[model samples]
Target: MKDFLAELIEIPGGSGYEEQAAELIAKEFSRLCDQVHTDSFYNVYGIKRGSVSLESGERPKVMLAAHMDEIALMVKDIDEKGFLRFTSIGGVDQRILLAQEVTVHGREKLYGIVSTVPPHLQDAGEAQKVIKMKDMCIDVGLPPDRVKKLVRVGDLITFRSPLATMQGSMVNGKSIDDRASVVMLAEVMRELDRLQYAAEVYCVATVQEEVGTRGAVISTYKVQPDIGIAIDVTHGETPDAPKEDTYAMDKGIAICKGPNMHPGLTEKLIETAREYGIEYQISVAPGPTGTDARSMQISRSGVPTILLELPLRYMHTTVETLNLDHIKSGARLLALFIASLKEGWQEWLKY
Candidate 1:
């Protein structure tokens, strides 16, 4: 898992430009699935056939969705001094940009450093104000003519935070937001390979989740599965954050219960955890969640949907962090839940 995650995050797959990452995900999905396909939106789908047959001549379909897009930047302008100005693709905090290393995916991959006025160079009260993204520029150490020759106004810029293993079972790096969940799908598929299941599984790595739930909306409509599960990251406990708003990393996986989540499916998830001795924490949301789960729930006349989250810290930033062990725990729980589905799967959807 560590080696695969390390290689996955290094590929730059910002929203609206996910072709490269889609190719990699498709390759991985091909290894575990009976058939693999990539959509026009760059959404990758891998289908695993069910072993059991029903009297209706159709097996239940389960769709698992996790997005692969990360918050990124795009070149909006170029200054006379050869420096580049950028705009964010997703929910990027402009405050975190100063002095950060990034790669400009122009004609070629150009290494650059996000820079702004130095504190010492700022006027008396100027240092007290937050630096807007417009004020910051990327320095690629190239002359104006050279930069113009290789770079365009709309080139994508991705942060250069390589994955790093921390003490114990934690790892921190860029794009862990949903990429971690993407990897968890692989873990689920790997576990499923060793078990017998009755429902066909469609593992989908969606695109452009950060921009909106666009990919989820399209993919869910296409799959039209009987059940949908969206895997994503939620806020992890931080010293300054309120306890109620953030979850603990040590709690294993977060099984969300809310209006957007089908009550029966959520309960089934909990029941599976208890029966299998899986560690889990319950999260409640009064309204729709800001995840692909929301879109999946309402797609195509309505599909029963559930959300599973992995606790993460410093979300939407390059230094996002999570516990590695939780991935294994979540995978086991999902595999068991899928294996538990029987001939009367429709009955499980009742309130």
Candidate 2:
């Protein structure tokens, strides 16, 4: 899982540009699933057939969605000095942009560093102010004519930080937001390979989730699954953050509950966790979860949906952190929930 995650995070798959990451996900799923394919929107789907008899009516289709896109930047303009000005592809914080190493996906992979006015050059009060994205530029060390020839105004840029293992089983790097969840889904697929199940599992690596839940909306309509589960990241407990607002790290997976999720399905997930003795934390999402689950719930007469999250610290930054143990636990919980689905499971989805 660590090695796979390391490779997965290195691929630059910003919201609208996810072909490279989607292809990699599809290839991994091909090894574990009976059939795999990518849709027109670049959403990758891998199907694991159920062992139930054809006489048992159509097997319930279960869709497990994990977005492959991450927060990134796009070149919005180029200065006369050959520096690149960029805009956020997703919800990026301007506070972390200074001196960050990034790779510009232009005509070629160009290395660069995000730059701003150094503190020594700032005015007395200006030094304390936050640098907005509009005022920042990337130094790619190229001449204006040379840069214009190789890079365009709409090139993608991604953090160049490599995943590093920290003490206490924690891994840190960029894109752990959804890539960690993606790895958890992969682990679930591997677990299902050895377990008996009766539902058609559609493992989907969705695209454009950061910009909106567009990928999930289209993918759900295509699969038309009886159930949908969105795997994402939530806030992890940090020293400065309120304890009540964050989840415990390395302890368990967070099972979300509230308007966006089907209450019955959420209950079933909690019950399954208890039955299997898997540790889990409850997350109260009173409104749209800002995840694929939000869009998935309204798909085609409403699909029963649930959201599962892995606790992450320093989200949307290059040094996002996650514990491997929590990922394993999340995968086991999902695999158990899927394996526990039996005949008449649809009836349980009713309010």
Candidate 3:
């Protein structure tokens, strides 16, 4: 799982440009699922048929979703000096742009470093102010003519940070916010491959989640599943962050509860976790979760949805961090829940 996640994080799949990551995910799913396909929106779906026969004449369809897109940049302009000005593709915090290494996906892969005015060269007041993304530029070390020929406006850019394992099972890299969850879904698929399950599982790797849950919105409509579970990342505990606002990194997976999620599905997930001795944390989302769950909930006549989150630190930054154990535990919980689905699982949706 670590090696797979490492390879996934290294790929540049920023927002709408998720074909590469989607293809990789589809390849892995093909090995574990009975069927695999990619939609026009690049949302990859892998179906694992259920072994259990039901009198209802129809097996429940369960959607397991993890977004594949990450926060990135798009080249908005090329200056006369050959510097590239860009805009955020998602919810990017402008404060981390200075001096960061990034790869520009233009005519070809070009390496560059985010540039900012040196502190010594800036005025006293300017040094104290946070540098906005508009003021930041990428220096590709190419002349104006050459840069224009290689890089055009609207080219995607991603952080060039590679995944690094820490002392224990912790790993850090860009895009761990969602990629960690994607890896967890893959683990769930692997577990299901060996188990007899009642519901037809659709493991979906959704795209364009960072820009909005556009991929989930469309994919859910296409699959029209009975239940949807969105795997995502939440804030992890950090020394500087408030303890109440973050979850412990290596403790357990977070099962979210709130208006955006279905009450019955949330309860079933909690029960499944406890029955299987799977460690889990309770997270509260007062309104829409800003995840695929929100979109899935309102799809068609409405789909019952649940949101599971892995604790991650430094989200949307180049050094996003998470614990490997959390991924494993989350996958186990999801697999058990899916396996626990019965012939009359739809009856359990009653509020």
lDDT of 3 by residue, 203-321 (tens): 99999999889999999999999999999999999999988779998779999999999999899999999998988999899999989998999999999999999999998999999
What are the Cα lDDT values of the candidates? Answer: 0.91, 0.91, 0.92
- 1-351 per-residue lDDT for model 1 (tens digits): 877788889899999899998998898988988999999999999898867677766577999999999999999999999999999999999878889999999998999999877778889999678889887899999999999999999999999999988999999999998999889998999999888888899999999999997899999999999999999999999999889989998988999989999999899999999998999998877898888998999998899999999999999888999998988999899988988888788998777
Local lDDT at 188 for model 3: 93
Q: In model 2, where do residues sit more than 4 Å from their true spots?
A: none
Task: Mark the regions of model 1 whose C-alpha exceeds 4 Å error after superposition.
Answer: 125-127
Q: Can you give the lDDT of residue 242 in candidate 1?
A: 87
Across residues 47-157, which tens digit of lDDT does each residue of candidate 2 receive?
A: 998676545576778999999999999999999999999999989999999999999998889999998677788888997788789989999989999899989999999
* Consecutive 10-residue window with the lowest summed lDDT within model 2: 50-59
